[model samples]
Target: MKLNTDASVGEEGWIDLGVVACDSAGRVAFSAARRVRAFWPPEVAECKAIHMAVRLAKAQGLANVIIESDSQVVTTRLTTAALYFSDLDTILGDILEICNGFNPISFTHVKRDGNTAAHNLARAVPFGVEQCWENHVPRDVAPYVLMDTLSLD
Candidate 1:
């Protein structure tokens, strides 16, 4: 499967954003885009990204999924569930609910350099936009996308 994913955050403030895709066999079958608003905290954003990924995997009918992220907090939370989620309990709850729909899901932490595509997309998220990928992302995010794709190798 060739799952290509990317994300970016705007320069306005501290925002968490991400994108994930699932390929069935050799085809790009499912994709997810997310951009947490300014109100949503980082932890919430992180969990939402994972939730989106898992949901996409389930939607694609994948039994096993290899999820990737640059945020150590998100990775640790998903893997060990040891982090304190006081601020994001609701978001975490939502993520856990989505997780129940998947058969098996895994999380991996990659360096920011490796997760450039998603980071770039997160940065591009507009101020008022919540989460969606209906329009074309900025071309300036290409370099990061390339970097992200290469890192997967």
Candidate 2:
């Protein structure tokens, strides 16, 4: 499975996080959009998005997955297993722990343009709500998902 994730911060300091997982054929496996209270920086929000992706994959019984994010800092930290000295340390640790549940998992950084599906999903999510789609595409994110499938083809 390939999971693309992204996060956006609203003007009022709320964070919208999204994760979209697709199979080799580009079929949507799982997708989630969540609103989280703001306290940390954008990098932390990115980490949250990725952590959610790992959890979703595990819940769906996927043993191997490649998690992609548009945030280079978050991806680099996770991929290198670097020890962060700040509040991110805890979130990073949690991400690493989540990875342990999978037989094989990898993290990669991607350009924001390449992560449009997750971007749109994150942007569309209303604050204070957590919505998820499993085994099918949500109507609001369908166009973006189609674009992803086209690009993969």
Candidate 3:
């Protein structure tokens, strides 16, 4: 599975985390959006998105996945030996722990332009509830999914 995650801040200053997983065929395997009320930086929010992504993958019984995030800082940190001390340390630690469940997993960085599906999903308003879509994505994200499919052509 190719899992992509992103984070957006709503007008209410709520952090919205979005995660989307697709099969090799570009079909959505699972997607999720969550709204969090916190005063975290964008990088922190991105880490939370990744955290949620890995946890959700475990919940869905996925044994392996290539996780992607738009935040270069976070992904770079995850792939490097040097851990910068900050709020992200704990969250990154937890993410790495959950990542152990998979036989092999990877964290990659994608440009914002290439991750529109998760980008738009992060802007979604789930009203303090974490919304999830299985076997498909919400309507708002379908166009981006199609865009992704076309790009892979």
TM-score, per-candidate, Cα-based: 0.66, 0.94, 0.94
Order the numbered candidates by lDDT, best leading. 3, 2, 1
Worst 10 residues of 1 by lDDT: 22-31
- The model with the greatest lDDT is 3
Candidate 3 lDDT (Cα, 0 to 1)? 0.88
Q: Per-residue lDDT of 11-123 in model 3, one digit per residue for the tens?
A: 66789999999988899999999998888888889999999999999999999799899899899888773466777898988888898898788889989988999989877
Candidate 2: worst 10 consecutive residues by lDDT?
Answer: 123-132
What root-mean-square deviation over C-alphas does model 2 reach? 1.2
Q: Global lDDT for candidate 2?
A: 0.87
Clashing pairs in 3: none
- The predicted structure with the larger lDDT, 1 or 2, is 2
- Local distance difference test, each candidate: 0.56, 0.87, 0.88
Report model 1's TM-score to 2 decimal places: 0.66
Candidate 2 per-residue lDDT over residues 60-90, each given as its tens digit: 8899899999999889888899975788878
Residue 28 shift from truth in candidate 2, angstroms: 0.4
Q: Per-residue lDDT for 68 in model 3?
A: 91
